[model samples]
Target: MEYILGAVGLLLGAVIMYFVGAGQRKKILEGQSQQDQSYKLEAEKVVSDAKLNAEKIIAEAKLTAEKTFSEFKDKQEEFKQEKIRESREKFQRFKDEFKQEKEDELVELKAKREALKEEQAAMKEERASFKADRDEILKLQEAVKIQEQQLEQRNKKLTEEIERARQKQEELEHQHERFTSELEKIASLSQEEARVRLMEDVRGKTENEAMALKREILEAAKEDAAKDARKVVINTIQRMCSEMTIENTVSVFPLDNDNVKGQIIGREGRNIRAIEAATGAELVVDDTPETIVISSFDPIRREIARLSLKRLVTDGRIHPARVEEVVAKTKKELTQQIMEIGKKTVVELDIHNLPSDLVRYVGRMRFRSSYGQNLLKHSIETAHLCATMAAEMGMNKNQIKLAKRAGLLHDIGKVAEEDSELSHALYGMALCEKLGENPIVVNAVGAHHDEIEMNNLISCIVQACDAISGARPGARREILDGYINRIKELEEIAKKNQGVSSAFAMQAGRELRVIVEADKVSDQHADELSFKISQEIQETMQYPGQIKVMVIRETRAVAYAR
Candidate 1:
């Protein structure tokens, strides 16, 4: 019974194990089927997505190819159009060049035709001259026989005249002898003595008449000369009417507002110092409303400073480095402007062939002053005056040009960069000569101030024009103290000379009259003293125009009857 119960339990256990295995297998199969279905749906979705992606990619490729083709076509069309334009331009250029060539050829042909016509006319004239010469020779041949016949008649008349003259000569000799004898009897003197007395009387009377005539002629000539000189001077003065401008050492740089002054001054005044150091000018930024004073003895420096400040303010980048850069650039620009001014001045003056160095010097004259007169204006005035005077004197074109050039360059030495001990006139002369200027121009430059002897008419004209320009009323001015000091200095220069009793400055220091004691200075010594004083003044003093040193040595006899 124990064995049977064990078997039954084993079988029941086996059956239960079988049933559990079958249930688990069925659940595994259902899960596998669900996974397959899920995977199949996922695969179907992936395939559809891939097909859509392929279609999209293919469509994009087609669009790209079509776009590329269109681009290529557009590029090709553009290339064709460009080539066509190039060809058209080339053809037009060729046609124009050909037309120009044809025109040139036609011009050449016309010129040749004209030349041929002229040659033909010359040949015709030569032929006509030949024909006329032939006719003249024939006429001369016919007239030669007529002249021979007339010569025969003249010879016969001359023979008859010779015979008549011999008979008249004898009669005249007898009459002369009888007259001489009668004269000797009346005068009670020998023939020779009476002849001598008559000659002396005639000589005395003729001498008195000639002296009187000479004095009258001299007086008349002097009067006419004075009148003519006055007329010319008056006309010259009237013809020229130039405006006057006064220049000062300081320049006023106007600002838009006072606010700009702060930028110009900068932090700690560094900007101001930089500008001053760079431009060699003083910037006076004071309470002056909307203005900065640029103080400098050199006008160029003032101009540079003014322009540099203007740029800095306009640029709104004020700093030490920027200030230096602007200043340097301003200097360069000013230099170029100076050159342009020089070129323009020369062109306006109608002067040519001036060296670049001389042109630069001429430009510098715009910044310079002489005796308070603007040097450039003075030079221009002098040039015009010189040209006018030369024209008035009937000078040739070359001479007039030379006069103008010399007048313009007369004060170039004042603007020269070199340190010169010589006077401006001499230094200018040297400068011109060094630059291979004309000899007449050099002489005029040197002799304008009488520093050297004038060598030509042009030199004299330059000197005269320079004087006229300077001596014009209101052309120049001087400080009162300076003017007074100049007058006193003129007098002192003359008084210091030996044998000078007293000195007077006249014509606003244009003339110095020195009175010398007659006992101390003779007439010859007076001349020498005048020359000495002039030399001393020339070497020691600087004056506008020229000073006339006149030494007066007159003896006054004092015998008063009481």
Candidate 2:
């Protein structure tokens, strides 16, 4: 029984194992089927989504293509319309121009046709007129031929009468010759000797008459012109005799205080040396209180030094560096001041459009002096004279202004030069040319000093004005010592006279007044004394113009009470 049980158990166990294996295989198959279904569903979803996306992409491409084609079609239509419109406008314009050209050609052709018709008619008329004129000319020629024949007959008759007269004259001449021969024999003098004496007497009378006529004609001509020439010269002199102020080389600068002089001459005189070196001027510190004199052969340097010292003393900042800076600044200011003065002068004279460089050069002349005459002042006086003369002459005002400006600038080059060898005239001309001055001004400047020949009226006028201004009385001066000596000499001459008690030189030594003692000299003697002094002045002194000699005869009685 145990064996049998074991066999059954084993068989049951086998059975159970078989069933379990079968169940597991069935679950495995079911799981594989479910996984296949899931893979199939997932593949279907992917394919559906791919097909939907492809359809959407195709539809969008078609819509975009349609929009692009529509736009291209619209652009083509617009381009066609514009081209047609442009072509139409061009054709219209061409038609209008062609129509206008045709109208013009038609009018011109019509006018030509009318002119041709008129010319044809005129030619026919001319033909007829020419025939008439030719026929008239032929008739006049025939009449002239008849007149010529008549004139020939008259000439023949006149010739015949002349022959008869000539024959009669020959007979008369023969008779006269016989009578003359008889008379000659009776007188016993030949005809040749008588003719010779008659010719000699006629020649002598003709010569005497010719000489007398020549002398009378020459005397009349001389007498006619002399008065006018003298009058012109005298009038010119009288017109130019106006008074002018003389310029002096010395310039004065007032001091702020007397103590400033000590500062100017610093410790060990270093300030003076610095000033002299910087300015190239001689500082004349003399006994004159509250005043300093700047002296130099060069007037420009002297003026510059005077200005610089004045500034330094006024500023009270005296040092070597400050001195140089102030001097430079003062010089610059002076240059500008000169330019301003020059421009002002030109404006006052109505001179226009002067070159900038030439204006500056003219300004430099303010610092220059010629024989104690300020160049600028002399120029102003000369300009006035020129303008007055030019107005009198009815010359152009602009030309007169130019002449005066050139005259004023004639000595501008002296600002840079010291010697007189190279004349300021030539130097000024060169400067003006360099500065692009007017040709007329340059010419006047060059000609004023005789460095060049005068080429125009302005040049001549400028030279004349310079001479008039310079030669005027008290227009210029030399050294003071010389001036004093001249005055003393004149006074001594008047004092040496018998009637003169004292003599005074007046008007800057231009005139002399003599005071005579009344007891010693009578009125008649005073007149004689005046005449004698006038003669003495004229003979002894070389003075310009007429000097007035006044003799004062006064009687005074004085009594002193004690």
Candidate 3:
């Protein structure tokens, strides 16, 4: 009974173990199925995504190809249109060229026809001249024969008259000799003595009459000359005014601060050296508060230096390269400035018709000064003065314009390059002529200072204006030292001449009074000496207005205190 109970218990245990393993295996199978479903869903998702991507790539490729094709079509159309336009333009150009060529040919033909007509007319005139010359020659020959016959008859008649006169003269000679002998006897003197006495009487009467006549002529001539001179001078003076401005050779440049002086002087003074060499002026960098001096004998160069230095200091980029660049640029700017100034001056002067190059020269005059007078301003003033005087003098409108234009350009040559041998007047005239200025204007420019003869009324007007402008007091200022030296030179020149014992330049150097040694210089010789001194002064000295030379030779007999 114990063995049967053990077997039943084992069998029950085995059945329990089997039921639990079956439950676990069923659970494992459900888990495997769940994993399979998950993998299947993942694979479906990957394949759908790949198919959708393939469709997208293919669609994109088609779109790209279509766009490229459309663009290419558009380009092809553009090329076709451009070619058509070019062909049309070429055809039009060729047609226009052909038409122009036809017109030119027609014009040439017409010119040639007219020239032929003129040539024919000239030939006909020449033929008529030859025929007329032949007829004149024949008439001259016949007239010569008639004149020869008349001359022969006159010669024969003159010979007969001469023979009769010779016979009559012989008879009269005998009677005169007898009468002269009788007169000599009555006068108790020889014929020569009596004739000399008669001559003395006649000479005295003639001397008195000649003295009276000389006085009358002198008074009349002086009266007329004074009237004419007074009229012309009064007319010019009343109508004109000239203003002069003087500029110095050195220019002062203002600085912002003292520190910039280093930049201007630069390393080893290269900047300053470059500036000096470029502008032909010396730059004075000194220990002042805030100023630099540009010194040069040439005002234009000094001006350029001052301007360039100002710009460089303002820019604060001072170096050799910067200095050179600024100077060059400033020079161009200054040139342009001069051109503008010249143009405006011309306009203000109411003058016109100047050569373009001459106009540029007029602009150059702004920087040129003569005797402390600004040349450009002087020129403008001269133009106005000339115009006024011309109008007052009853010149025509065209003449007045010419006179004014000439006055404006009269001193253009003063701005010519230094060391040029030509005088300003001649040089300006040459420049005007080269530029095709009016001949009358050229004459006026050259002849205004009497360097050449006055060719027209306008030239005379220019002369009058130039004189009035320069001769005005205070128009020119000579340095005091130079003026004093000039006065000394005048005295020296006068004293240097022979027979001039003492000389004094009186009337502010307008007149020279010379005391000549009476024993050495005669009254007649004193007049000659005065002329010589005047000529010497003219040749060697430069002065305004007239200089009179008076030479006195006094002869005094000492009979005092007897």
lDDT of each: 0.80, 0.73, 0.76
Q: State, as a TM-score between 0 and 1, how close model 3 is to the true structure.
A: 0.44
Model 2, position 208: C-alpha lDDT score: 51
Instruction: Give the candidates in order of lDDT, highest first.
Output: 1, 3, 2
- Candidate 1 local lDDT, 117-192, one digit each (tens): 8867986999999899768656654555555565456546544554555465556556556656777999788998
Best-first order by TM-score: 3, 1, 2
Q: What clash pairs does model 2 have? A: none
* Stretches of candidate 3 exceeding 4 Å from the true structure: 1-248, 254-259, 286-291, 417-419, 478-546, 550-562
Q: Top TM-score: which candidate number?
A: 3
Over the stretch 413-527, how does candidate 2's per-residue lDDT look in tens digits?
A: 7765445566777877887888788898889888887879888888888888888777555667645666677788889999998867899988667679999999888765676
Give the CA lDDT, 0 to 100, for residue 318 in model 1: 95
lDDT of model 3 at position 43: 51
Residue 376, candidate 1: Cα error in Å is 1.3
* Leading candidate by lDDT: 1
CA RMSD for every model? 27.8, 33.5, 24.6
